[model samples]
Target: MAVDQGTFRRAVARFATGVCVVTSLEGRADHAMTVNSFTSVSLEPLLVLFCVEKEARFYDAVIDSGVWGVSILNPDQRPAASWLSNRGRPLVGQLDRIPHHRGPETGVALLDGAVATMECRTTAVHEAGDHDIVIGEVVGAAVPASGPADEAGALLWHRGAYSRI
Candidate 1:
């Protein structure tokens, strides 16, 4: 039997996951999006991966940029996450409203108050149904000086809701 989309979505939502903003810059164009599908792929090669909807505005920017940044949101970054995720919002103006800084290594913008951020160079891309799986090799990472090492204040997503870990 073929599983329906709602059934798959609801089932996957049961797994609580951290929130992150994936960002990229291609020449004068830049884009950011809230994502929860980010993951570590391998440590031996310092690899990571995140999936983006093929139709998302930021999708092509990420592909063309070849490098991207992942900002692991903290509890206080709920607004940033919400704003970036809204498909109706203007992509050009999204970053201007947030407290952010450009990654020194990749030039992709990183959210300022995130618990941690990482710069990754895209190593591979695969089309996965409605989304694109981007595999990257981590090149640099940073944590706030006072950020918690534990997951106490990490921003989490579950059952179509946002929560604190």
Candidate 2:
């Protein structure tokens, strides 16, 4: 039997996932989107991947820029994640309200207070259904100097809502 898209999506939603904001620069403009499909593919060479829908405005910018930043969201960043995920949100000045700093290596905006951040250069792009899987090699990374006791837990997506872990 063939599973329908709704069924597949619902089944996959049962698995909890961490949230992240992927940022890239297209000329002097910045583009960003909330993504839960981010993951690490390999460690030795430090590779990571994230999937972006073909229709997302940030998609073309990211594919063309070849460099991007990943900000692993903490619980306090839920608002930023929600804003970035909205459809038809302005393509320009999207990051203006969000607190961020430029990544040293790629110059992409990395959200402030994120649990961790990574700057990557695109190594490959693969077509998958309506989305493209972008794999990148990490050239730079950052984590706060605070101890574990002061760190905020990660923000997660579960059952269509945000949760903390």
Candidate 3:
């Protein structure tokens, strides 16, 4: 039998995850949303992937722009994560209230205090259940000026809460 959604979610939460904000440009506006389902797929060509809910505004933006930025959050960037994750926040206003910089390669906005950032170009898209898995080729990457090279202290998601390890 299929597990209930809540049970599945809770079970999945047992696996600790790093939190990030995936950013992309939609027309002339910037779009971003908190995401934890990001993974590095390969190193040879430098591939990465993030999953976005089918209905999320960021999903469409990623598809339209064919590029996006991944901002790996630091422990101190919880407010940035909360703002991007909040569903009620207007999409167009997401970036206006935050201090961020546009990536040189993709022009996608990356949160200012992110521990690390990667600009990517979409290489493939696969639909799965209620979300879309977007795979990208990393075009550029760097750590924040104030961020440490060791990421053991990075912000993480576990049991529906944010934490640092």
TM-score (all chains, Cα) for each model: 0.94, 0.96, 0.93
With a 3 Å backbone cut-off (N, CA, C), the pairs that clash in candidate 2 are: none
Model 1 Cα lDDT, one tens digit per residue, 1-165: 999999999999999999999999989777899999999999999999999999888888999889999999988889999999998788666799898888899889998878889999999999999999999999999977754533447999999999997
Model 2 regions more than 4 Å off: 147-150
Estimate every model's Cα lDDT from 0 to 1. 0.91, 0.94, 0.89
Q: Order of candidates by TM-score, top first?
A: 2, 1, 3
> Per-residue lDDT of 1-165 in model 2, one digit per residue for the tens?
999989998999999999999999989999999999999999989999999999888899999999999999999889999999999898878888999999999999999889999999999999999999999999999888896513888999998899998
Ranking by lDDT: 2, 1, 3
Q: Which portions of model 1 show Cα errors greater than 4 Å?
A: 147-152
**lDDT, candidate 3, residue 58?**
75
lDDT string, candidate 3, 57-121, tens digits? 67778899998999998888889899889987986677887789989988889888778899999
